[model samples]
Target: MASDMLLQHLDYLLALAAERHFGRAAARCHVSQPTLSVAIRRLEKDLGIVIVQRGHRFEGFTEEGRRVVTWAQRIIAERDDMLADLERMRGRLTVTARLGAIPTAVPASPFISGEFLRRNPAASVRIEALSSREIARQLADFEIDAGLTYLDDEAPPGTRSVVLYREQYVLVAPAANHLMNAPEVAWSDAAGLELCVLMTTMRNRRILDANMAAEGVQYRPVVEAASVDALYAHLSHSGRATIASTAWLPQLGVPAGFAARPMVQHGPRPVIGLVVPDRAPASIVAAALAEVADDVDLEAHIAAAWDAAGDRRG
Candidate 1:
């Protein structure tokens, strides 16, 4: 069979692996069930291997068949990338930028997406708030095109990255709360307030815990939530404060009667940035977004916002 024809059969095999059923895989590929089955058999014959386990229905692939599917994903991905590159050169690459970001880093999504859309008017980005570990998992599974996350020890290995900014955790509380307005607030001091904080399972929370623990302080929050948004809701309704990264301030702003105060420097800043797969991106739109990330001065934008609102103690 011609190379393109063989690749099409591989596509059918991949679809079967994903759907795990013959009829459904055929429907997904928009081909008849028999057509898909024949293609798989042809693929097996061309390679002289039993790529699929025969059964009354779709079962599974042999070991070598799994390897073929893996390489097929790569092969199809690179082919699509090349075609997208050609389209981009002609200014017609329309794509959706599926992106994931840790809740702390969600504020930076616009800085990345704004420039990306401006450069490619035909593109769009959707940002989902997720934990750092979830972001890495999604990237590995090709569930998202790119991610904004802590680039320190938390970043997954075998990924390519460009650091955007060093995150500074700050105290967000009611402006009328005189207990926290100072040049800076120490962790121990912040720990004594009515508090709502992220759950310990989150990377940001772990870092916060490690920092305060080093000072012989342990944060026991009045409310512990799993996500930044949850913590924000608690702070808003319960009239409490949260120790969140500076990234939160520029995006959500403090709720009414609130301000953001710098925390005392406790350790190295958590560098946050854009990360993508080490291999060719599964989507050309992702490649474009990563390229945009490399050039955008998100650090400057974030710093300017932070400086403008430094200790908003009014």
Candidate 2:
């Protein structure tokens, strides 16, 4: 009876648990609906306990099923780690780097991952744009091997974080805006301007708010958006302004007809870095990333890239 169990069955069960619908779970596993349901039922029999709460439609998991789902996640994660370790020992390692990053750090991903890819030529990459808090949670849960986020104020406890660069803030607006001519902009002065701001839930937005508050100002934006692109759209079309970090300028660039002026703030400047789980499992990609980070002059390289992009786009 024990021989009846298979990793594929567990995979099906996990898919079902996540999707919560037989048809959708089957699609996720690239199998037919009946095939998925049958596999899940097989999992229940092998475990000798009812895993799912069956109903006319797709119902949630049973009590035992929830526990099994937790084990399944751990089992899958350990399997990947074991495979990665074996590949490393054989000196023919090929793996994918799974990374989670805060929104502001997304722009700098290419710079960090590019160097790692050069060393591990066969490796692939996947990056999710998440909040700083979510990045820490994913890293802790073993969902993501690494995270890129703000390191100074709220770095996750018991994690190894290496600072890549210190981020400086600026006020970005269309050249046609009145503030564009100034060598520097004050936060109090910006509070009165039409602005497109990041959602308040984002840590980057909170940091921006704190910086503005330090200068005796409160920035009440005319618009709010989840993505930097959306904020840029509003700022560009409506002659509004947005705050950006110098690190992000490398990827976003100063668009034609726009200028980025340094913000004069006596507030805290955030240090951005790469964060990995404390004593993470035997994952080669995460270790390789740490190794690559140690060898590069990341700060100078990103500064040059940001400047080059500005020159081209400005």
Candidate 3:
């Protein structure tokens, strides 16, 4: 039994196990099911055990098949690691950034990119749009080089952060809504209002949730939207109201009948920022980028948010 030959069939076996259908696995491997079946049979013969149990409905893998799949995954992982090392040696730096924002800061990312490219021209960057929890998980797995997310709350372990901006939370409603006439309304006045909000998955939504809970205000949002477009769609036809960051308002292009104002006893606004792993000895580009982004006019952004909020009230 040549172990090398068995190793060659490992990929086929794993694919078959994953797809759980012979024809699909063969298609994935670019081979005929008969060819893959023969190869797997040869591998099983060499190992002196049955690996797969055949059936009309693509029945399950044998116990030994599960073990083989585990080994195959480890083998593939090592292969990926080896390829990454080779790519690194060839001077192809692959860094992924998972960024999460309140739909407002999506535009702000390009500003960081200009500076990032200036510093690391040799590196290739991949950007992922993620929610805050997704950003944190990707950072923990070393899947992302850095993330842009809210920095007001306690950060997850093994990460460092720098505030990039502060965003003012404002009340948004159809221009016809009653709150439009008032300069401001307190959180205590928020109850019994039909609201429209970004889905609870967003960090921005969570911040509002906490504030409302603290004020003993209970809101039942008649509309829930996951993105800016969805929020706008609902706001156009109905009297639904929502909270939005001031930076995001001008970009939303709200219809003529829509209005926005700052809340009295304003809720806590999130500090937008970048976060990176606090691992030992950061990459040269990573270290330099963090230093530069941190030194930017972050405090000025905070002041701007406050000033904008004040003007809206006045």
The candidate that wins on lDDT is: 1
Error of 1 at 18 (Å): 6.2
As a whole number from 0 to 100, the lDDT of residue 164 in candidate 2 is 83
lDDT of 2 by residue, 1-314 (tens): 55545678878887887688999999999999999888888878888999889889788988998898888877877778788788878776578889888888788888778988887777778998888888877776667888988887588776897778888888887776777677688888878888888888788898878878888777678988877777767765557778887777767777667777878867566888898876646466777777776776768866786667553322
lDDT of model 2, residue 8: 84
lDDT of 3 at 106: 59
Candidate 1 vs 3: which has more TM-score: 1
Order the candidate numbers by TM-score, best to worst.
2, 1, 3
Q: Give the TM-score of candidate 1.
A: 0.79
Q: What's model 2's overall lDDT? A: 0.79
Per-prediction TM-score, please? 0.79, 0.87, 0.62
Clashing residue pairs found in predicted model 2: none
Q: Which residue pairs collide in model 3, if any?
A: 175-257
